[model samples]
Target: MPVAECGRPASPLIVVLSGPGGAGKGTIARMLVEADGSLRLSRSWTSRERRADDPDDAYVFVDRAAFEVRRADDGFIEWNLFLGCYYGTPVPDPADDRVLLLEIDVAGGRQVLDRHADALCVFVDAPSDAELYRRLVGRGDGADRAA
Candidate 1:
């Protein structure tokens, strides 16, 4: 039975990492998850075309219809469309006391904060505009617009 149904106390940790498009939030998240055994990364679903250098398992690439269906089924805890592409986080069911890390954008981060007051919210970014631009360019994600 589920912990809630069993009346067992299991307070899982949810970490929501958010920042601007060219920010280093993803990099930070990756590093944390890699270094911590108790932290699990919640891979989000996206309808956007994958980036050239994106890893094979960076995201669950789905079409619009599939994404909408998941939304209708309440699969995603938070979701939004940015830059004409849909991005959503699937409801994570981590083991008891484990930390679930979510690397998301500003809008989706707000949605998560509204639902989860206990979540640890972390905003990550480069040291300066030049650094941010340099990171984005290096990652093959050009600036979405003029800074």
Candidate 2:
């Protein structure tokens, strides 16, 4: 029997793993997907170049032009700009059986929650402000904002 949500059979759950930059959402999401056969991580699209330490598959790296084209074409379910870079999640295939796992910026995560009321969200918080700042600087991703 299918699980019922809001009086209807629940679709595969969208699990949003959100956090501030360098808070390790990607790491946690990867671990979850590796451990759970039922989860499939959705790689978000971004105009920003991948960091040296970032895994090659962290995001669907694209130029600004391509990102804008997709955004204008209504390809993303939710999108946001952070530190002057565009990041967005694509529309998922309805036939997919594995639950979607997303590691995204906080703003975009909020948008997802608003759009999908049934989404299950988990915020990966930094242990401390100082530690978060260190991680940001170490990643060379402009930690000045966090400072």
Candidate 3:
């Protein structure tokens, strides 16, 4: 069943930010929230290999069992297993009356659109493949030529 927006299912501003792996979704989300106080970035929970310097404040890192428990309890707006890891958005407090920005992948974006047809989906794109590769490699992950 598609998850409906709390109360106002007709027109809720569910902003979806999606792009290639190296595209700057996190940066954009931060900027949007900083610029507009009414924008809320939904913090995601993950059960994945964490990066060494990733600010622990970024995501709620958990083991697979814990994540599954949350999912079973319907604590997530959307959850999925990706690339051998789990990732999900926690249910936002709808009473906040803010634009909820969900930084998700193409598949997750589709799920949000399916649930809320009125959602504003924004596809963030890189200037070029070279630029994306450069950014990815610069981030300390050895970029592949095919990337």
Question: Ranking under TM-score, best-scoring first?
Answer: 2, 1, 3
Judge candidate 1 against the unseen true structure and give its global Cα lDDT, from 0 to 1.
Answer: 0.81
Point out where model 1 deviates above 4 Å.
Answer: 1-9, 94-97, 143-147
Tens-digit per-residue lDDT, 52-90, candidate 1? 888998899999999999999999989998878899999
Q: What local lDDT score does residue 26 receive in model 1, on the 0 to 100 scale?
A: 76
Superposed by TM-score, candidate 3 places the C-alpha of residue 60 at a distance from the truth, in angstroms, of 1.1
Scored by lDDT, model 2 comes in at 0.83
Q: How much lDDT does each candidate structure score?
A: 0.81, 0.83, 0.79
Candidate 3, clashing residue pairs? none
Candidate 3 structure, TM-score to reference? 0.82
Please identify model 2 stretches exceeding 4 Å from their true place.
1-9, 143-146
Considering only N, C-alpha and C atoms within 3 Å, which residue pairs clash in candidate 2? none
